[model samples]
Target: MKKPKTTNRYCKFCKKRTSQKLAAVKTGTPSSLKRGSKYRMRKRGLNRGFGNKGKTSRGALGSWKRYGVKGSKKISLKYTCGDCKKVGLSANTIRSKKLQFE
Candidate 1:
């Protein structure tokens, strides 16, 4: 099999590429957690009696209805040079726009 493309790119926070490690993409939940206990599983409905109504449940609304809640999964990537952490969205957006990296 062909090897995956891995790059030793510089991290502004680290101020160097030598310390950068290959980060694997996290795809999904582990198999061991897939079969959650029956006692832990809660019923899905408008009135399941948790806190507020189930109307606020993440799965209840469509993407358009959810708006800001949708597409909000962000990965934290830290840099040592600036001693700061950057989120995935900002990093991806900057890269896509071809903006000059500092």
Candidate 2:
């Protein structure tokens, strides 16, 4: 997908319409200290000591590479106000194989 470098958009902070610069939003890596990561680590430890864990004892049937493939990537975009220098997030996410700014 090709997006315009600059577009006229409404600036909520400024309370008016202005020409804004378009930029893609990049996500940062997850922290190991997060709550989800800690819970997963505790769950794995519990399965190790138990005699019978039912279906979990068998573990995964196959490698993760064999399934759950996605066709496209979700891209997030944001616009920067030219006057106020404040950034605003786009309302919707785009799914595409490639994204380019024109």
Candidate 3:
């Protein structure tokens, strides 16, 4: 696999990107882990429920849409400041500053 490109940019929260590093991300565990062993052994929907196809239901297109959700949920990796080690600023802020300097 190819590596992602990095540019000479300032991390406002960190104040600079000189010492930043890529942080490892982890995957979420299955919901079944929360149940007891006995419960896990019993097949789900064995009695009252229909088979997987008809039993499972989902909303139509745009049915689950919500408004005013914050941007933090959409971003995974954040730029950690090399100077102060803080991590919450918009990426556009960095880009605008770079353009101004150039």
Query: Which candidate has the highest TM-score of all?
Result: 2
Number of backbone clashes in candidate 2: 0
Which runs of model 1 end up more than 4 angstroms from their true locations? Answer: 1-6, 24-60, 63-90, 93-102
lDDT of 2 by residue, 1-102 (tens): 999999999999999999999998997754455443533444565768854344223334123323336777889999999999999999999998889999
Query: Considering only N, C-alpha and C atoms within 3 Å, which residue pairs clash in candidate 2?
Result: none
**True-structure lDDT of candidate 3:** 0.37
Score candidate 1 by lDDT: 0.35
Tens-digit lDDT track for model 3 on 1-102?
122332344766545445543332233544463343323323453554654333223322123333233333332334445556655433432211111111
lDDT of 1 by residue, 17-98 (tens): 5433223233454334223322123323324655534333444343335536534344333332222343112254111212
- The global C-alpha lDDT for each of the candidates, from Candidate 1 onward, is 0.35, 0.76, 0.37
Which residue runs does candidate 3 get wrong by more than 4 Å? 4-8, 14-17, 24-48, 54-77, 88-102
